[model samples]
Target: MKDNFSGHSDSYSKFRPGYRSELISYLVSLTKRQQCAWDCGTGNGQLAVKLAAYFDEVYATDLSENQLRNATPKNNIQYRTEQAEKTSFDASQFDLITVAQAIHWFDFDAFYAEVRRTLREDGVLAIVGYALLQVDESTDKVIQKLYSDIVGPYWDPERKYIEDLYKTIPFPFHEEKTPVFHDEYQWTLEQLMGYLETWSAVKHYMRDRGENPITLISETLKQSWEGFDTKTVTFPIMLRVGRL
Candidate 1:
């Protein structure tokens, strides 16, 4: 898959939001066995660390060594540098497999082939992500401009999958109906800025334009953020679950 976050691995581990417990609980509930799990494109081991608590073993893989290096260590979680489409995993190895916020970067057909090869017959494959963050209407307006007007062209074509909430992505399995979930956090303007900087589109813009794009909207964000030092930023979680 793509290795966009490796350069800013530390910032990604620090600024990226964690998955809600409810989401994790639901994934666990779907699994018939908690024997093992594979978290592909597991940047910073965010989801793997949580899976470690439920599974006997958690294998987390990513293309970037820098990202793997920054991953949180756990006794049951084994971090590896590997691609999403190919791996050394044995057939019928994992009870559950997950790709959080990174499936858009994968070769879907190849990855699905690997999933079918390695995943147990009853195993669940969960694809998870979050939509654009929503603050108040005023703050959202400035952020949307930055997202659409400033760095819109910089975003990769794969981003449309997230925009459509994964509905448009190819899913060739027995899909399960999932409940809607959200990640809510009380974040300062600085935190929001840091999160924005983690966007792959922002990185692309910086590389092409030779300047940070967030600067274009800093003052406007501050002006719109005036009444509150901290505000609840909600990200509607996008999830698609299925079985082999």
Candidate 2:
């Protein structure tokens, strides 16, 4: 089955964590010039919107029309309906190119070919991903059980690239060492549930089994969240940065 995200664009836009400003600043620091950046697979423009502050222009592309429709618009950001592997822009057009949590879905050869074509000789390419979110120990255990036991099998095989932090992807460029980064969020039980519902595996489980898996663990999670006005969740952000 194809990896489809159009159906959950709303939840994705609302619940998916945004990158830290420090991360964006770090990526910007690597660029020779901030004239242009292309944010490939920019679901809801999370990274694209952040990139707008640094680049003179940001081209954000996604294959899903619904995703682009829900993207936050900025004066410097241009949202486009285009595949990651095939964009219409000319050669050597970007000072930087970034992919946020969506590189696993790409046809690597085709996408990298396009990247080599569009990126300037001095341009940088950044691929970013976040590890699983963690709440308190008890709550995390409950969520981990749900992830590993309940929805694990439902996740696409492509998820392994992210699980390994994209170590296996053919990254043929001068690599750069990046500082440690994490995206942190404070959320109530309800908010946590909303975020969990946005997982692609959870969505797949619901569609395949015709039952919401979150419902199976809701009471357990609530119990674990007891006495907590809000829970702190953190995802360790992973980056693969290189120069062309």
Candidate 3:
């Protein structure tokens, strides 16, 4: 299971997008108290670090030691090496629990049970994700071909949960309306390539084929990316916020 990110922790830390402040503000408004938050599957402490600014204490846990090692520390955030389904936290200790971009990899039955065990009744649970990124129609075509035709077969089956926007997942909670937000970035071709290098499917394709598959799309991507100073890209950030 940990092998999914076997050696890509560095790329993940450097390249993965961060959550927008609007999402954080919306979560803060929903919580009755901003006492504590538990960020499960907190790979590289991305969201956890941000949560630390709002919550008094932030508990960030992950199964991957290397990912934890790569995490940048904050005074209020505590990092732990642990699985999503099993934790040593006290019962009803968290006012908020967040799972960002990593929920598809969790054992849902075990994780939801743990969430109920750990979260306060008034606590908010936010399952955060983002859809495919878009720069422009032309750039999107190159990316789509690389993602669908080239690396699609290499993606783990669980990725469908993200593709479907978590619609089929069992989320038993009193749902709350959330604000609309998008995670945007102005990145050069190299930065975009760096981000693509962090994809699990790309990693799988490299390991199995003994060659970097992203290289195949370099020429095609240049067609759209070369002349632009820095392409503007955006992802529609999705949040399923609720309470038990």
- Per-candidate clash tally: 0, 0, 0
TM-scores vs. true structure, each candidate: 0.99, 0.97, 0.97
Best by lDDT: 1
Model 2 lDDT per residue over 56-168, tens place = 99999999889999999999999998988888999999999999998888888899999999999999999999988887789999999988999999989888887887888
Q: Taking the tens digit of each residue's C-alpha lDDT, what string does model 3 give over 7-115?
A: 8888889989989888888888889999999998888998998899999999999888899999989999999988888899999999999998888888889899999
Clashing pairs in 1: none
Reference-based lDDT, each prediction: 0.95, 0.90, 0.89
List candidate 1 segments past 4 Å from native. none
Indicate the worst ten consecutive residues by lDDT in candidate 1.
Answer: 1-10
RMSD of each: 0.7, 1.2, 1.0
lDDT of 1 at 94: 97
Q: Which stretches of candidate 3 lie over 4 Å from their true place?
A: 1-3
Candidate number with greatest TM-score: 1
lDDT of model 3 at residue 159? Answer: 84
Residue by residue across 33-141, what tens digits does model 1's lDDT show?
9999999999999999989889999999999999999999999999999999999999999999999999999999999999999999999999999999999999999
